[model samples]
Target: MDVFEHIQSAKGPSLFLLPEWQNRCHLLTAGFTGRSGGVSESPYTSLNMGLHVGDMDETVIKNRQLVSDALDWPFEAWTCAEQVHGNRVQRVTEEERGSGRETLANVIKGCDAIITNVPNVLLVSYYADCVPLYFYDPVHHAIALAHAGWKGTVQQIAQETILAMAEAYGSRPQELVAAIGPSIGICCYEVDGPVIGQVTLLLEKLGCSDDSADTMLELSDNGRANLNLKEINRQIMIKAGILPIHIELTQWCTGCRRDLFYSHRMEGGSTGRMASWIGIRER
Candidate 1:
């Protein structure tokens, strides 16, 4: 749960590497550079991997290569979506690899979530403010990655991934270990009237008491309220049958920690993206 600071290098922007991922199997780690880690001059900083963003294509390519070299994993190992913000889940295979800088139209079908049973095929989804959910099933030898924005959260994208694993790879929710990666936490994720109402409806449908959900959230001095996105997603996981003990959450908020991660809410669309990826190497 420690936040690692960025270490500048003359060659390129280096990410604060995680010790857990060096040789660990069935492990998840991503506390890398924020918008500032890389060779990009301004706006995109140095490590922006988002192709759709307005950053120069060559700069994005250089940044992606930097991230791949820093992690010591092949750039082709990661797969991402155009991210339509839906409930669809796509299965990843060895054939889908090799996109050092693949165009969006080439790889992005109609999927928001990705799962893989093949070793070394990492499933990745980009984020500036949206929550990324990572899952691993040691028993079934499977993995799933999901992007859960408010709409996707309400649709329970995490639950859908678990269900997909069960159907495709015989993975059970109870056996699946999950981690809700860094994103815009409730402390910084303010919503308008309709958005709150949407969340309220989902919360109620999930059997959360109306009184409790409403009461637990209170306005700050300036009238801003903190809503725990991790907690709510955790509730969805449990209701879908995952045990509480198998879940992990980070208190890091993308908006709050702008120096370590990107935040769309914090930087009004002129921002780079932070990516979370997970893969199981072959035995």
Candidate 2:
């Protein structure tokens, strides 16, 4: 079964929702945004959620409003960070709610992952082809969002986010329900040089068997390789103590579904970004 369900209306933004998590907890809303039904122009086309991507501030804000409206969430609760593709995890509190919603003035800086137990704060991270990792510590009412590119992945951002949650909210890894959101898949993501080297080191550190390592990273004779980031992150999650059964991995690849998602790799570097958001409303 596809863990993320695609929902679209003729007059609304296209969204991929995590229905299982929402049904498991009515107050929770978790999903990824798509590239249609908004107001940005050309390359961006419409529904560009990233302000840092050269889209007009007003246009991106309007697009964001459309998403929040569709989700029935107040735009005021939309909190985000300035992602540096590092493994730093910021602990969001009520005080940080709404940071970087409209402008970059107060965006949580220097962090690629944000975790919080603060209800009503919608934690969001932007992505085009890079992976979006979600962590829900149901037992502690804490949630986290991480942006993992090859750099962050090799740095073990998933494990870092899990440890951050445990330290901040006493979240047990076994009780953490996680989701790996849409991004480029191995079929569409090819890398070489330092990327392959870094990933090779990471697989070695993860203690992957030869067959498993080859599956996560298929090396070609030409010194290039196809990387399965989603699977690598899932293995990192399990290595960090999260149970395999509790994680939901999505099959949606932004690189392959250009009509539904904006792919930086496929789009010649100028593209919009989608958002991965997870929030729990106040009870």
Instruction: Pick the TM-score winner.
Output: 2
**Pairs with steric clashes in candidate 2:** none
Q: lDDT tens digits, residues 12-32, model 1?
A: 555543334333453544434
lDDT, residue 250, model 1: 66
What RMSD does each model have against the real structure? 3.1, 0.6
In candidate 2, stretches whose alpha carbon ends up further than 4 angstroms from where it belongs are none
Model 1 accuracy (lDDT, Cα): 0.73
Q: Which ten residues in a row have the lowest lDDT in candidate 2?
A: 133-142
Instruction: Assess each prediction's global lDDT (C-alpha) against the native.
Output: 0.73, 0.96
Give the TM-score comparing model 2 with the true structure, all chains together: 0.99
| Model 1: lDDT of residue 55 | 80
Cα deviation of 264, candidate 1, in Å: 0.8
Please give the lDDT score at residue 234 for candidate 1: 85
Reference-based TM-score of each model: 0.87, 0.99
Deviation (Å) of 46 in candidate 1: 2.4
**lDDT (C-alpha) at residue 54 in model 1:** 83
Q: Which stretches of candidate 1 lie over 4 Å from their true place?
A: 2-33, 210-226
